[model samples]
Target: MNAPDRFELFLLQDGEKKITEKIFTGLSNTSDFILLKEDHTLGNLIAEHLKQAPHVLLAAYKIAHPNVPEVMIRVQTDGTITPRDALRQTCQTLVQMYFALGREFQKEFALRQFADQGDQGGAGNAGGQGGPY
Candidate 1:
């Protein structure tokens, strides 16, 4: 079958706003969140993180179709917390993880750069003579 014709729904243009809203479910402690202009990258990440939350009973996400750029994430939580709280906690955890990853990456990058500089014989090499170790 052919894809949907709504290109604007999938594409983000200048001055366009990103949308995220909660869809209340008939059952308590369960809700669906809609995230527009997102794809599997975010959906999978969120699902994985949500699954890690102790209070979350279920966490899943799907796209209606590949043509659609929106993700519908359904979360069911225990009575201890709401789905919104689980999602909020997931976001915070993800942000902290991201920062930690960046910090580790910077440290590794600096180490690699220092190693490379050392290999290049780092300054004070006159007349291309090898220095004594």
Candidate 2:
């Protein structure tokens, strides 16, 4: 089922395989999450989400708003954050929130973070020194 939206959610199932995909045009708005098909691998959907997000809000934010604390405070206070910074922070926070909610966006966010961590070349994998591993 196709709906007029920037994002659409789909699901596929085949024998013992099941996959879910959520597609969106941009990263700044809410759209319908359609459940599509019955059985298939989820590779396509994950790829699509990653593809759209970066070119749209994701890439823009990487430079515009790179700080998480400032973004968080700005979001809560609605204070004097620059337009670009505000937009970037908003987009990033929105994607993160959606993932936390276990929405279709989770896959895309997870994949992106995974790639980012890899790019960091295992720099900060270690957790809190105060805690046991």
Candidate 3:
């Protein structure tokens, strides 16, 4: 039997974020299934991040391999946002998180330095009393 032609469907697009559905007609019937199996975890991560958007109604990704591997992504919104917007927001949130962590590290490092200086000063003032005779 001849394989069908591969095609992609766009379920939604509003000049911004878009959802794409890809159909891999004959790939799923192959003996190697590792890539397809790994895609499930990747798709779940994407769906979870996309759902963090405030205007997102629903976001999901699935791979069907009954005969061939087909990937589908459906992202619904409240008409006030797009998938692109949600993605941008997610990136911004991640950046903010990283920045906060860096600041905390800097604060901790400064505190450690201050404590070490105080210890050194106190030891110097002890006038060789390092060991209790």
Candidate 4:
């Protein structure tokens, strides 16, 4: 599928109830969206992943003091990390943190596509012989 066809469903669950909303997949899937949302949910998700990286504490320091010059300086001033070490750790962490959700998204897309392809008069998932997922 091309970029335009990519989409995601965000499911919010509260106890037994589920609230679903659709979001387009694109730049919106990245950190910028998290920064835009007033809700802390997305920020928490990013923070959770970021916390796993060695130099994330330095990033957190930078976040806390946005006006600080040179993250490497701030990271070292507190003692522990060297400039080179922090850079290497940050890059390694980011590389390891890349999570591929496309396969799962495609599976969801396939199931939705399958549902749409089925006979409308029958119960959902009832008419199809089997889905390819």
Q: Choose the strongest candidate by lDDT.
A: 1
Candidate 1 matches the true fold with a TM-score of 0.74
The runs of at least 3 residues in candidate 1 whose Cα sits more than 4 Å from the true structure, single-residue gaps closed, are 1-27, 120-133
**lDDT per residue (tens digit) for residues 57-79 in model 3:** 76676676644343455556565
Model 2 bad stretches (over 4 Å): 1-79, 103-133
User: If scored against the real structure, what TM-score would every candidate get?
Assistant: 0.74, 0.20, 0.40, 0.29
Every model: Cα RMSD to truth: 9.3, 18.3, 15.4, 17.5
Supply the TM-score for candidate 4: 0.29
Q: What tens-digit string does per-residue lDDT give for candidate 2 at 1-133?
A: 6653332123232442232223333433322222233112322333234334332222111112322111111111122433234435544765675566664345556665776677776555433122111
Say which candidate scores most in TM-score: 1
Model 1 residue 67 CA deviation (Å) reads 0.8
How far in Å is the alpha carbon of 60 misplaced in model 4?
1.2
Taken over the whole model, the C-alpha lDDT of each candidate is: 0.80, 0.34, 0.51, 0.36
Flag the better candidate by TM-score, 1 or 2: 1
List candidate 4 segments past 4 Å from native. 1-48, 54-58, 61-99, 121-133
Better of 2 and 3 by TM-score: 3
Candidate order by lDDT, decreasing, is 1, 3, 4, 2
Residue 82 displacement in candidate 4 (angstroms)? 7.1
